[model samples]
Target: MRHTVERAMAAERSRYRRFWVAEHHAVPGIASGSPPVLLAALGARTSTIRIGSGGVMLPHHQPLVVAEQFLMLEALFPGRVDLGLGRSPAFTAPVRRAMRQEEDPPDRFADDLTELRDYLDGTGAVTAHPVSDRTVPMFVLATGQGLAVAARLGLPAVLGGPLLESPDLAAALAGYRRDFRPSPRAQRPVVTIALDITVADTDEQARALVLPEAWAMARSRVTGEFPPLEPVAAIVDRPWTDQTRRRVEATVRHAVAGTPRTVRRRVEELTERTGAGELLVTTSTYDRAALAASDTALARIIGG
Candidate 1:
């Protein structure tokens, strides 16, 4: 895992762009503690690449503690930390109950988000020393009503969905632009779209690589089975029929899984549709060589 992260960091540096880390702590069979450790290590290794969580599931941690941990990270890395917060519990009911018996109500997310900002700014009723007055950017990961809250606060937001055909994505971005209240940190709305990408040498290979991850995600959505990612061979051997592919494609159309030329054409279409200023790419393969090849292909696509 450490080596994979190091290679990713190296790739990011070579590409001269920022990359955010995706944390899947609750994903069964994966090492849970690797994300934070990997982020810190990447921060130390790279001189200019910005390091951040694609999002941290905020409901899983106390806001104050989260503020402190992120503050420390920002203090060490200074100018390169981003805190992307998500409201999902990121686990099953039993796991959530075990973690916090008296978890705060979900309705309190807006208030908690405000308080977290205050704590980070050192203006909360209880002061935090090192984090006060620091200028690390905070981004909210929003899919629905959370988008409205982020806009009201004038913070940048990241959304996961299809850019071209998603009415929800259009509505959320419009709401943010319309209702945004200018803060000292941001005078204008900032929107980022997270897209699932799996690039390979050919369309067939890319789709083959994506099927296992897509299948696992689909199965997990229905059943709670969180298994380690399997190879394309395993997915091809599964009983999923063409009907299943059509069903999954309805929800997974946002994913860009094909050759670099094909993926780039889709990405260009998405950019025109969303007017998003940034793109976050997420891949699900386990092999470092495959991951690097995909990222390299993406870089060429974007740069062209």
Candidate 2:
């Protein structure tokens, strides 16, 4: 994963805005469990690109600790650190128990967000240190309630997953803008859309490139575990249940994968629908070479 980030991102540093790592604990498919640790390493390898979390799940840790960690990151990297916060719970019941999070826990997201911001802004009762004058911008990874919280608090929002394809998407974003409050952190509303994007020579090839991720997600829904990505040939040769096939098809349909022109058109449509200022490509495939090529093609499409 580190090698992929270094090659795909650092190679074309000017093409990317931020290299955002995700936080997933005890998920067999995901290697990253700590965003801060990963961000520190990525930041050292690249100079211009922003390093941040796609996000850190706030429910898993205290607000102060989060603030201190990001602040330390800002100190190390200076003006190039971002902190994206999310309210997602642990992966499973056992993982939740392991993390000491209650099953169906009460939502403390808004409260935690407020406290964490206070520490970053040096307004909390206790200061989180290695503090500097520069601010580490915080973004909320919005789903449903998260949008409202972000709007109310005057923070930028990162929207992804099924929400991007929701019938009420425009309405949801409109509501976000309609109810948004401006703060010192942000004087205006900013929306960034996240999707799994892949580019290849042809539409079929592009779709195939995303099959491993789609397959993994499909099986995870039924098996209760997100297994490691398998090669495209291995995935295709294996027998799949009817349910798996449907789920895989659904996932593949959601991902934007095709030739450069095809991808550009889809991306433009997303921008038109969401009025998003940025696109967060979360594409993952087992073929590292193909993935890198896709990244390169995607960068070219955006004139990066």
Top candidate, metric lDDT: 2
Error at 235, model 2, angstroms: 0.8
Residues 62-160, candidate 1, lDDT per residue (tens digit)? 678778878888888888788888777645666667657345664777888888888888888887656545676889888778788888888988878
Cα distance off (Å), candidate 2, residue 134: 0.6
Error of 2 at 147 (Å): 0.5
Query: TM-score of predicted model 1?
Result: 0.89
Q: How well is each residue in 205-280 modelled by candidate 2, as lDDT tens digits?
A: 9999999999999888888789999999999999999999999999899999999999999999999988999988
List candidate 1 segments past 4 Å from native: 29-35, 101-104, 162-165, 241-253
The per-candidate count of clashes, in order, stands at 0, 0
Return the lDDT, model 1, position 140: 87
